[model samples]
Target: MAKGLNRSKLAGCAALAFATLFAGAASADGTVNIYSYRQPDIIKPVLDAFTAETGVKTEVLFLDKGLEDRILAEGQNSPADVILTVDISRLTNAKAKGVTQALDDATVNANLPAEYRDPEGHWFGVTKRARVLYASKDRVKETAITYAELADPKWKGKICMRSGQHDYNLGLFSAAIAHWGPEKTEEWMKGLKANLARKPDGGDRPQAKAIFAGECDLALGNTYYVGLMRTNEKEPEEKEWGNAINVVFPTFENGGTHVNISGAALAKNAPNRDNAVKLIQFLSSHKAQQVYAAQTYEYPVEPGLEPSDVVKAFGTLNADTLSLDEIAKNRKAASEMVDRVGLDDGPSS
Candidate 1:
């Protein structure tokens, strides 16, 4: 409409703008709202891809905590169609809170492993992560390690870890309980606590940082964090922190490595119910599985798929066949054992 515009050019521009607005409007009915506890950077791309593939717009409400509480509080008036989060305990907790509805979809069932999804179908796991070992590149020599070996006197005063109360640690402890029973896991925790390099403090990355500082020679950390730290650009020093150690996917004497899921569930009262199920199905699709795992640095839950190239460098993981459902059942005992063994109290000294 200004000096340079011919009427035809001006009309064309207006038409283009209107078409763009109309395109967005056309997809309004396909919008799937998500209540997610997972960090935005990790899940947004997948959501974007979902929109691109299906014309389904995704609106996310990112929450650091209380996702279940908020959804429950909103009740039937809630717009939350899906809940995206990590950890089996949290998923089980959401189910216990009555915020999620059971989904019965053939595509989801075909894609997710039985061990990774709820038996009642309240959630479907899309990726796999492990609480694996982190050992100093300068000191630890053994390539193969066992979780049981963490308690051996040979490694005394040589290990670093986060608080035993941390969900990451709890996941492992619950898996241990599932594998070894309460009495034995409690004993194992005590001996492992006796081997601490320092008081249980800091998150997983700090454990590797401590190793780099020579405070300890070994640590317990999630596998994905190693990839995140190693590739971190904003915190370049974390790459060095990552380089200081190697991840060891420790296993039980007769079992495979322990692993958990980053998964999503259907909300009980989805405003956009069909679109919500479509979103969940798209998430578990092979393409989404590849993107989600590669971006998040986690292994894909859909079998025959591998984690990103960076995660593969740590070594192949033979995930334990024990159902996460089984591990979840043992969580209460695992938590009690952490307290009973005074794991957070550091060693007996």
Candidate 2:
């Protein structure tokens, strides 16, 4: 069930300031339109809650197609007042393209860390996810390994991963580039590619499944996928999938793993700019943030909200502190390197 929002719990002086700017709805009847890339099943609960509490009947266009491309094509004619999706790289790209506006809100600015939100304020992350390693407990002795170790000779032909072109992979590789200069990171990628157990070919869940089938010893994946597998009520197979591997946070002496996010932005010419701001702020509020973190098995962007018990049971992690914008900015270079080394071909299923 979708949770309800209570304005009484709104935090700090930011709330008082936001109260003045609180525009409930663009239309007289209280409605807003959203264009979302997040799957309907995953995000609908939260949207339902938002609508129920505020009377803001959210009309959504759920597209599996790229949100940026769609918004770009829509141009000024886009009916979208709000944009939602995962991955900092994609949000940063949209910001670069001028598809979203720089939202000026006192509460949003004060509550969100400067690094987490765009410098220009084009977007803010609603929730966070960590990049983690899913290694077979029976095969690997060390419960922990550094990101650089995945390139070691011993790991050669022992690693499983998704397509290098995928945003998550590119984001991790981009972080590697940021940590070490391009040349070393490129060498690392080539070596990592050489070490592939099979051609890198599956989404995170499938890669975890590969480990269960004895196809690989370790697979790169996100923290949330493990949460979903463990908690998904509709699928008994996912419970079996969750049991096959152990989770590891690959800290590169930097002391944490890479983390990404699902974020939101206001459309460039949002007809209901005030209402859009309210909707986004609502998502960032503690109530929505908690629901997002618990439901998605992602880390909440807010400081005090811990992940749900399912995620807590998997264990804890310190996320790599590099600002998401830097990772997004370097994604192009990461993609180029992935192509240069032929990792984009991925493992064959």
Candidate 3:
């Protein structure tokens, strides 16, 4: 496991970037500067291995938010060579922001699937997490469910999920748009909203907690949260939440489950462009995917790389054939649908 840099060092992005200006990691061979939206602990081992393998150390500035904005603000003077972040929506948004440049890496192209990488080569998915249902094991008996079924009246006021506007849900919502078209997706959103247990709130883990508490019978969340809850040490009771629910990789009536990725892109003004490309290529390699899978319990984007045992136990993810770029294209509309349907307002009393 990798240790995280001090959270205090993460306070002010510009100040931290300035502090590490010249004396950051790497040797005379030069280092790759990364501005990551992902927390440090999760990616440190992968970075350490990259440095060990290529002798190119990485200086990472971990930020909870504002990654693209910072890069845009720094313009060509930005020291960042790579942007590591979660969610395909964020990656695409970064590209839309014009802070990321198109990459031209043969290694990355060969290692990752077309649907998982931008056609322009701006970003590539390293790990994927499926959006699956968390159904109560005690109260729910059906082994199978589809994404559209969440709108069924039988489940009315019985579904629990976070905000529909959240990136995870938005990604799934966008997929709905891709599959059903905007008008039908809007109706689906209305149906889904009519089935909510309460005003959408909290992270994915809380939905599991709500299930355990008997507040709801089904929830929507990513596959990894189950593995994390099952293995939680800081909160032993979280294990009960895992025990209370079973994962269902919900498919569309005609397709598969909606999934998202934690991917990375090349900075438009990267000072260490070659080194950055090397690091990005390394992330798609089998070795890095293995470490990434075990550490975060996310599925590897590279074909033939298996997920951790914990993730597999959730059930096989039949990922939808819709391209994530297509999903990304619908996100703004998806978000608008959430508000149009008042999904966060909860089901009618």
Candidate 4:
């Protein structure tokens, strides 16, 4: 009788253990995995909020470069459910590489503007940042400037910029090519090259720093870097660099200012497809949009959402209406024009 009782108790314990293992597996399956080019710190708050609200866990893999390549290498077995990245080049490149898939969700379409999302639903823009001029407060007095004006001889030896091949400049140059044919764009590139303050070197913030040191009177930089600089309590010198310049919104002759985006795409082989869709929808929501604007200092892609006060102070952004698809199409031509015209060889070359 004692032996029978012992066997029954052992069977009960075995069943309980099996139930716990099954529950753990189910819980693990509910997690959404992400591969991102964006820094982990920038997106953590939103991801944390998502977990809290939906009880769906998130796992992020951050990389500074080669995000799409990694996903491609992982192939059908890739654990990536979502992809977060910045710039139209990266977004379109991921599509071209066949690492991203289309997402045709009503919630996403409603939350983001059509112009900001891929027409075929391959990717969606979550935030925008304008590529604007940073003019030294003591040097440049012009409040209004045109993109064509950058090539004028009057500003010779007064401009500073990063590598012409960089994605940011390529995006702007691509927009220029979209506005004007390659011939005219090349000529404009030559003229702009003639006006460079120095060889194309450093990132946007360094260009601002050059202006602060009076090395150049004007510099090309993104809108958000200015906000980052202005609010950088940890780096006091950068704050001074922010204060040394005035943000100038430059437009194409017949268009508005050039703007780029930080966007997301659904992975081609998403394991947790439904959870990934939910995360993408969550990102486009007003709540997530607000968090992006406040944390990244970027303009929200959502129609009614406002940018952070720091960004608002920079001046209004009249973003050009050129389709990002058009820009992506022109990127190769724009890049060829850059190398052919020797734009990166500096003014002296």
Candidate 3: tens digits of C-alpha lDDT, residues 18-136: 63563344223658988898888999999999989999888888989888887776666677889999999889989999999998788898999899999898889999999999999
Alpha-carbon runs more than 4 Å astray in model 4: 1-27
Which has the greatest lDDT?
4
lDDT per residue, candidate 2, 1-349, as tens digits? 1232343333333434432232343343566777788877788878877877677777676877767766665555556788898999778877877889998788887677776788888999988888889988788888878898888888877899999999999989888888887999998887788788988786999988888888888889999999889776899788777878889889866787888999999988676777778889888888888887787888888877788888887788787778888888788899999888888664332
User: Each candidate's lDDT (Cα)?
Assistant: 0.87, 0.81, 0.87, 0.90
lDDT measured at residue 301 in model 2 versus the true structure, 0 to 100: 87
Please give the clash total of every predicted structure, in order.
0, 6, 0, 0
lDDT of 4: 0.90
Query: Order of all candidates by lDDT, from best down to worst?
Result: 4, 1, 3, 2
Least accurate stretch of 10 residues (summed lDDT) in model 2?
1-10
222 in model 3: Cα distance from truth in Å?
A: 0.7
Clashes of 4: 0
Model 3 scores worst on lDDT over the 10 consecutive residues at 1-10
Residue by residue across 39-89, what tens digits does model 1's lDDT show? 888898898899999998887778898888776656566677889999999
Clashing residue pairs, backbone N/CA/C < 3 A, model 4: none
Using alpha carbons, what is the TM-score of model 1? 0.91
